[model samples]
Target: MDELSDADLERYARHVILDEIGEEGQIALLEAKVCVVGAGGLGSPVLLYLAAAGVGTIGLVDFDRVDRTNLQRQIAHTDAAAGTPKAESAAARARAINPAIRIEPHDVKLTPETVERVLTPYDLVVDGTDNFTIRLLLNDACYLMKKPLVSASVVRFEGQLSTYRAFEEGPCYRCLFDAEPTEGLVPRCDTAGILGPVAGVMGTLQATEVLKQITGLGSGMVGKLMLFDALDYSMQIIRTRKNPDCPLCGATPAITRVGG
Candidate 1:
């Protein structure tokens, strides 16, 4: 078990007060390692809240630079950071929020060649990337590597969050969508225009799910999918099941390796 310092006790006073996440839980958080795949909108709140909660080590992977448009939803970056790499900017914000934690910045795109190498070090992975190619790759990689994956996506006013323990008889992302959609088939936020707060809400919920998974605080979204409709102010939880034909986690897996 990790020991909390006098300063740690004070800094996480609220968490320590909760009976569910007492000193031991706080210590677990301090010893946990999490990797966040994107530093954009969804990654922003996930990174910030996890850092504030004192997650011991965080890995950020993003190759894009902070753009002017990112300011609206990517709260971790600012106007001055417009030209900076998203991973670097998000890392700076995480460090600022909790200087005690270690932030590893991988200022590179998530590719088939680097997928396993990038995700192997962490205990958990949060999928915040916006594209289908990387999303598919992450799902397969996590299933193969046996890492828990917290995945969520936001478009316009709709967002979905789900946790996968596919390695342990639970459903994986591939169970929901077997194959990546053709390019340009789905419009991105950059083209469709997403409400900033919707992404924030999903990302924040993603952070909560991460904390829950790490500390074993409560029932997680292992076999469920949460849907948030910000436009209608409604939410729904849908149960998911593993597909025997799932290419990644099925009875006879076809994809035995990344990019296979």
Candidate 2:
């Protein structure tokens, strides 16, 4: 266990004051290694809070560049950072928030051949990505590695979040999404058009789950999916179960390797 420095105690006074997250939890947060695999809308709050809360090491994976249009909800990037790689921009912001923490920015696209190498160093992975291919690839890799994955997705005025840990008692992503959706069928935030605040709401919730996992504070959303609708401010949680026939995490698994 890492002892909190005087600066750390001062920086995380609020966390230390909470019974749920006292000095012990604060130290755990400072010793955790987390990777947020996207630097766009959902990644904003996830990165910011993880850094602010003293997560010791954070890895950022992104391939896109920050555009001026992303400022509406991609709060991590500033007007001056336009055209910079999303991972780089987000890393700068996180460093600004907490220079004590280490930030590793991987400004590269995630491919099957490279996913394992890039993600293996982290304790947990956050699926802030909006791409189906990467999401499926990550689910397979993480399940095989037996690492916890905190995932969230948002489009239009609604969003959904769930934590997948097939190694544990929860279902893997493949249990619900057995296969990737056909291209052009599922819309992304760019095409479907999302309400700006929707990202903030979902991303914050996503960050909360990440903290919970790090501290083991409360029950996680392992077999549960949370649905948030901004239209009427309604939220619903749907319970899910592991699929014994899930191809990725099933009894007779087919995927033998990260990219197989």
Candidate 3:
């Protein structure tokens, strides 16, 4: 285990002063490994906060490249970074925020093969991907690997956050949304247009859950889903339970592997 240097102590003074996140929590953060599945709007803030909190190792996965349209909410990528891989650009921004972090970038789409290989190394997984295919794949992968999965989604003015740790008796993502939404029914940020700050809110919540999980300082979102409606500025918590018939985590156990 690496000890905090004098510079680190000064930098995280406020964090160290907090009762919930003192020196011990900071050290736990420094030793924790987290994997983020996308580098778009949600992934942007999640990566930024986790890096600032001194997470020792962070894995970034995104196949998309920075585009002019992404500047609206994807704060990590700048105009100059246009055409650069999103994962690489995100890593660069994260490094700029805190040089002590070690960022691993995978400039490739999350597929069955890559999900297992990339996610297996991390202690926790954060889902910031837009598509359902990748989301389901991640849910299954995290379940099989017994890794904590902190997930968040934002669209238009609404957002949702949840934590899934199948091994710990909490419900997995599949228990809530058994399958993907019908195609063309749910619009992507590129298609429907998302409010910038709304993404930041949900993403930051995801990072909070991740930090809480790592330090065991606060109650995690596990077994419940938090919903945010930006327009109304209201929040609701819905209790969730693991589906005994869930194909992935259920007794029948259809899913055996990360991508199976």
**lDDT of candidate 2?**
0.93
Residues 1-260, candidate 3, lDDT per residue (tens digit)?
A: 56678987988888889998888888999899999989999999999999998998999999998998878999888999999899999999999999988999988878898888888789999999889888999999899899999999999999999999988778899988886789999878888989999999999999999999999976889999999999999999999999999999888988888777
Candidate 1: RMSD to truth: 0.9
Q: Which stretches of candidate 1 lie over 4 Å from their true place?
A: none
Q: Poorest 10 consecutive residues of model 2 by lDDT?
A: 176-185
lDDT of 2 by residue, 35-145 (tens): 899998999999999999999999999999999877899999999999989999999999999999999999988998889899989999999999888999989999889
Per-residue error for 103 in candidate 3, Å, reads 1.0
The positional error of residue 188 in candidate 3, measured at the CA in angstroms, is 2.1
In lDDT terms, how accurate is model 3? 0.91
Misplaced by over 4 Å in model 2 are none
Which whole-number lDDT from 0 to 100 does residue 224 have in model 3? 92
Estimate TM-scores for all models.
0.98, 0.98, 0.97
lDDT of 2 at 59: 98
